[model samples]
Target: MTDLHEALRRGRARARYSQDDVGAALGVSRAMVSYWEAGSRAPNDRQLSALARLYGITPADLAEGRDVEPEEIDLAGMLLRADEEIDPGAAPGIREFVDFLQRYAELADLLGIPIRGLAQSPFVHRAKFVQKDDVRRKAEEVRSLVGLGTGPIRDLDPVCELLGITVYRAPLGADLRHAPSGAFLNHPEVGFSILVNLDMTPGRRRFTAAHELAHALFHSNETNRVVSNGRGPRESFADAFAGEFLMPSEGVRRFVEEVGIPPRIVDATDAIHIQRYFGVSWPTALVRLRQMKVVTADTYRELKHSVRPVSLARSLGYSIHPEEYEQDAGLWTIHRFPRPFLRMLRTAVIAELMSPPTAASFAGVAVPDIVQILGRPHGNAEQEQPQVDTEFVEFEATGVI
Candidate 1:
C-alpha cells in the first residue's frame, strides 16, 4: 500500500472507527472507504478534510503519512484518544459529534451567522474546582444573569442556546448501557457545544444539559472537553449545579408552601408535586428535598423505593408527557438535532452555500427531501428569472424546512 493509504488505515484504526461508521458519517459507501484505504481511489478535498477530522489528524499529517504527535493534538483529538482508553465503543460517536459541531460552525460562518463565544456571557466563570456551596452560588448567579428568577426552568435548551451554547440530541450508541448522560466541548472553532444522549428521558436530558452547561460555564478552562458519567468531584459539582439551577432551594420551599405541605413531613404525594412542578425526575426531586432537609432520611428512602413516578403522576390527575419520562422517546425523531442548527443548515442549502447532499447529511434527511424542501438551486438568479417557492420560504420559518 502507498504511504498515504497506510496512513489512512492507521488513522482509522487509531480512532477505532469501522469502515461502516466512516462511510455513514461521510455520506459515502463502505466500499469507497475500502478503495481509499487500498490506494485504488482517492477522496476529493472535502472528503479528505472530513476524513482527517474524523480520524483526529490534520490533513497535512495524513498527506505526509505521519502520526499526529502529542504536541500537535487538538482538543477533539485529545478527547478521542482519551475515550479510546476509557470507553472504546463511545469513541466513534464522540468523534462524529465533534465533526458535527465543526461542520455546524463552518456552515454558520459561511452563512455569516455570528458564532457566540463563552466570554460573551457575563456569568462565565473559570474555576477549576468548585465546592458545593460555590456551585450553588454560581447556579444562582447564572439564573439571575439569565433573568430566570428561581422559576422552574420550563425548558433548558433555549436557555443554553441563548447563552450561545449549541445543544444536540443524538444516540451515543445502544451498546453504551452505562453511557454518559452527556458531554461538553469547548473549541476555538465550535465555541461551546453539548451532546446529550437521545436514549435518555426528557427530564434526564434536561438535567444533562444543565450539567454540561456547568462544564461549559465553569470547568471549560480546566479542560477543553468533558464527558460526564456522573462520578468524581467535578461530576458531583455539575450535578449540584444542575439541581440548583433547575430547582433552587428557595423555589423548593415556596413550592412546598404553595402545596400546603409541612417541610419536615413531605410525603410521596408532595414529592410528586415537586417533581412535576420543577420538571425533574422523581429521584431528583426526592434528593433535593432531602438535601434541603424538607424530607427526613427515613421519608426520603421510603418515597424513593415506593414511588412509580409516571403511574403516580397519571393517578394524581397530572398529565404526563411520555417523552418527558420515557427513555429513547427523542431517539430517531424529527427533533434529533437542535432546531437552530437545522435552521442554519436549511439556510445554507437555500443560499447555495452548501450542496444538497451535504446539507441532507447534516440534517439527517435524504438529498431529495432537502431539494423538495428548499427547491432546486439556480446557479445565477440574476441571469435567469428566479422561480420563487413561497412554500419553501414558509416552511423555513416554521422549522426544519
Candidate 2:
C-alpha cells in the first residue's frame, strides 16, 4: 500500500493537474508543490485542506492513502474528461461519480457478478441517423433483445441489470444542477455504466436510463463517452428511441383500444389513468396519445395545461414521486449504496474478509449499526478470566491497619 506522500502524488496525478497548476491554484511556487509531493517538505493544515479541495477528497482520504493511484486515473478512459464534451461546472460531480464506479467494480468483482455489457457492437450502424426511421427500428430491436414484447416495462432497474448495464442514482443538489441528467461511459473494467440523476421524476429517470442505453448501444462507437445532456441530432435520436421504447406505438394503439376511450380524451382523469397504468410520465403518455391520434393536438395541449400528475396522484391517494422510495426507513441508510451492494458488503464482513469498522466506514454508517445488521454482539465479548489490578494496594499491603 502507498503511504501518505505517495498518496499525495497519486492524488495530483489522478486529478491530472500539473505541479504548476496546483501551485498557481494555491498561490505558491511550483517548486514548493514539487517539494511537498517529493516528501522533502510537509504541508501545513491550511495547505493540506487546499490540496484536499483541489483533489475533491477529504483531507483524511489523502493522508490515509485512500486516493486512487495515478495509473488508475484513465484506466477506464473516462469520457467525462473529454475537452468541451461536458459542462465545466459538472466536471467535479462526474469525477466523484467515477470514483464511486471504481469502488463498485471492486465490490462486484468480490461478489463474483459477471461483468458484461453492450460494447461497441458490429450490429450498430456505422453512420448517424438520417431520420427517425432507423432510430425507431433500433428501439424496437433493443426492446426485443430485452424481451419487452411490445408491452410496458414494469421496472427499469431489472431491465438494465439484465442487459449488463449497471445503473446508479445520484442525489439532487446544487452541486449536480449543471450535471447531465444521465451520462453513459464504456468502462474498461465495468463495460458500460449509466448514471441517472435522482432529482428527476421517476418517469423522467426511466426515460433517462433508456436514453443513455441508446447511447451505449449506438453511440458507443461514436465516442468512448457520451453525455445525454441536451438536444442535438444524437440527442434527438435518443429521445425518439426513449419514447418508442417506453411507449411502443403498437402498444399504445392497442392500449387505447382496450380502454375503449373515445377518439378524444375529454377528462384529465382519463389521461392520468393512462399515465399511471403505463408507468410513464403524464407528458409521455399524452404525447403517445397524440402520436397514435387517439387525442387531437389541441386536446393534448389542453390536458397539458390542466393536468398536474403529482397533485392528481395525491388526490387519488397514490405515491406519485419516484424519489419517495429513498425516504423509506427499510432501505440502507447510505443513499449511494444500493441494496445489492450493501448485501455484498455484509457478506464480506460475515466471511471475515472485512472488519465491521471497515464495512461501516464504506457504508457511511456507525460500526454498531453494521454489527446489529449482521446479527452479531454489538459489544466485545467478556473475558473468560478477570485480571486483578496490581496498582490497587490492599490495606495490609499499605500497612494502613
Candidate 3:
C-alpha cells in the first residue's frame, strides 16, 4: 500500500508550505501535523479534506500518493554555463527550478489552460539557423498577432500572456556565477513557459523575456528546453529575435528621424532618447540603431565607450527609477505568472480545491495579502472598532509596546 504519511509530507513540500502553516490553518497544533505525517496518526475526514485543499490535490490522491504520471521530456541540457563550461555546483538549483516548472506545468494542465501559440510561433524552417530577415519577419508576425502594430512594446508581459506562454521572474540564486539570464520550457502538456532571472535590470528583464520567447517559439519544441546565456547559435538567434521584437526597424527609424539624431551618434543623449522611447536599455537601442544602419560602426564603438545610458537619461532630466535603471521590484504582476494561471489559481481557491496558505505560497505573498488579493473585506467594521479602542487605551495607559 502507498504510504499516506509519506505522501502528505511530499505534498506539503511540493506546495512550498511548512507543517506549522498547515496546522495553524487547520486549527491544530504542529505536533498533530507532525504525527499525521510521521504515520503515528491518521487525519480524520475533516482533516483529510483540509489537507487535500492545502496541497491542491484530491483527498484520495493524497492518501494514495497518486501523482500525475511523470511525462517524458528531456530534463538534460538545461542549465547555467559560463564560457561553454557548465557550472557543476549550479546543477541542483537548476534542477530544482526545473522541477518547480514541472509542477507549474501540471497545474496549468489541470487548470484547462490550453497548449497553444505553437502554430503561430514565429519561426521558419524550424530555425536550424537563425537568419536576420527570418527573425525580423517572425518577430513582426508575433507583434502583429499580439496587436502591437509596429510601435514600441511598452510592456512585453501582456503579449507573452496572450500567446499562452507563462512567464516567471525567479531568483536564479547567486551560487551560479555567469548563470543563464533566462530559461525556456516547452512542456508537452503545458504549452510554453519562460523563467527570467529577477536580478536583472528591468530593461534586461524585458529583453530576457523576449529572448526566452524566441527560444520558446523556435528552439523549445526540438529539445524541450533552452537556457539562454547570450552565447552560441541558439542564444544568438534568440538575441536577434528579442531585439527585433522589442525594436522594429521601421519604428526605430521613425523615432530616429523624429528625434533628429545624426547617422553617427555624437552624444549619449541620443542613445538615451531612443532607449526611453522603446523601454529598452541604452545598449540595446543603440545596437538596434546600428543594425538598422542609423549609426556607423565607428559611432557604435564610440557610444559604447561613453557614459552609461541610465546616467545619461537621468542627466537629461528623466526620473530614472531604479527598476528602469537597475532591477525591477520582483512583486509586480508583470514580473509574476501570466493571467490564465493566476485565474486558474483563483478559481481553485473559490471552488475550495485549494487553501489560502497554499495560494499564498504560490503567489509568493503572505496570507493577509492573499485575503486582499481575493478582494475580501479586511474585517467587520464593528469588530475592528473595539480592538482599535482597546489598543488606544492600552497605549495611553502604558506607552507604545
Candidate 4:
C-alpha cells in the first residue's frame, strides 16, 4: 500500500520479472508482493530493504517513488573501469574476468546481498570446508546459516557470490568439453574460486558452480591428489555440497505444502513442475530432495531416471526460429566485440603481453582479425610491426614472449 511498494512493483514490471520472480528475488512470497502492491499491507523493514536492493536503489529512492533511470554504463564499461584500477600484471582474460566480478558485486547489490568494498574484498573469510564431523547435520546447519528459505533460486551466480564463493571463467581456450567443469583449490594465495566454462548450458553451469564451491572448502588445491575433476570421492563430497546448497530437506517439505504437490503427482509430469519451480534441473532437484530425505530413496531414483533430458532452451526463449539465422551472413551476423576484451587487448599490446611479433605468432588468430575487431587502433601498417612502443609507454604494462 505504501509508495515504496508501488515503486518496487513498477521497477520489477519494467524489468519484466513475473510476480514469482519479484518474490524469488526479494526473498518474499508471491502472495506477499501482490498483497503489498494491492494496498493490503506494507512490507516490513527487512522486506523494504530487500526490495530496494533488488531494484538497485536506496530505500529512500523507492520510498520517494523516483523513476529508476537506466545506467549509461553497461557492465562491460564498468569492467573497463575496473581494468584501469587493478594491477596490469593480471592476464588479459583474468583482468576482464575480474572486471566481471566487480560487476557481479554490483548485481549482488540488486539481488539483495549486503556486499561491501571492491572485487569481493579478498578479506572476507566466509567460505568454509564442509565438515563431515557429521555430514548431513553440517549441511543442515549451513542451510540455516545462509537462510536458503523456501524460494527457488534458478540463477546460481548470485547464490555463490552471496556465500562468498568466487566463480572464475577460464579464457585459455582449453579443451573445456573434455576437461571437467568443476575444480576446488584451498590455497591462501588464490583463496576460493569455482572455475567453469562460461559457454556451457545453464543447468550444467549451475551444478558445476556448486560442485566447485565444495572443493574450495573441502578438497586440496591440487586437482588430482585425491580426486580428479572426474568422478571420485571428491566428486561425492562436491555432490553432497550441491545437494545441501540446492535443497534442504525440511525447507523442501515446507515448499511442497505451500504448493500442494501430491505424493502420486511427485513422480509423474508434476515431478518436473516441482523441479522447475526450484529453478533446478529435474534430476538434480529430485535427487537433492531425496538425499535430504524429503522423499523416499525409491521415489527419488524413479523420478531421476524416468525422464529424458529436456531441452530448456525452447522453454527459456533461447531457441532460434526459422527467421533467426535467415541472414546471408548466417548466425551471429552482427559481430559486436566485448568492450572489456577490446580495451584490455589494447592495453596488453601496449604492455607487451605478447612479443613485438606476437601478432604473427598468435596461433590461429590473424593480425587483420585483431586490427579489424580492434578498430585498427595501433600505428601505421607500413612498418612490419607497426610501432607499438607508444602503446607500451602509455599503459606501462610488461610481458615476455
Model 4 lDDT tens row, 1-401: 24755777786554434566567656778898899777678877787776666555667777777876622212222222322322222235444444444443433433344433212222222233335434456555555556765456566656555565555554322344344453333212222444554434445556767776655544432221111244555566677767666665555667677778764444544555556666676567766666555567777677566655354434543333343223221221112122333344444455565432463233224565556444554555556343566666556655531
Off by over 4 Å in 1: 1-75, 82-85, 119-129, 173-178, 329-332, 349-358, 367-401
Q: For this target, which candidate reaches the highest lDDT against the unseen true structure?
A: 1
Predicted structure with the largest TM-score when compared to the true one: 1
**Prediction 1 TM-score vs. true:** 0.69
Tens digits of per-residue lDDT, candidate 2, 26-101, equal: 8899899888888888888898887887676777777677755323444223445443445565655566556667
TM-score of 4: 0.42
The 10-residue segment of model 3 with minimum total lDDT is 69-78
Compute each candidate's TM-score over C-alphas: 0.69, 0.66, 0.66, 0.42
Please identify model 3 stretches exceeding 4 Å from their true place: 1-84, 89-93, 105-122, 173-177, 315-317, 325-334, 362-364, 375-401
Evaluate all candidate structures by whole-model CA lDDT and list the values in order: 0.73, 0.69, 0.70, 0.50
Order of the predicted models by lDDT, top scorer first: 1, 3, 2, 4
Full-model lDDT, candidate 3: 0.70
Tens digits of per-residue lDDT for model 3, 1-401: 35889888877655544576567668898899899899999999889987887676777787777864322433433244212454444455455556656666666566666545343355444656767998888888888877898788887777887887877766554433566677876544455778776656666778889999888877643444567666678888888889999999878878878878875666668777888888887768888888877778888898888667777777788777666544545455422556665666677677776788987777556776567556576857568778989989999889676
Clashing pairs in 3: none
Task: Note the residue pairs that clash in candidate 2.
Answer: none
lDDT of 4 at 326: 31
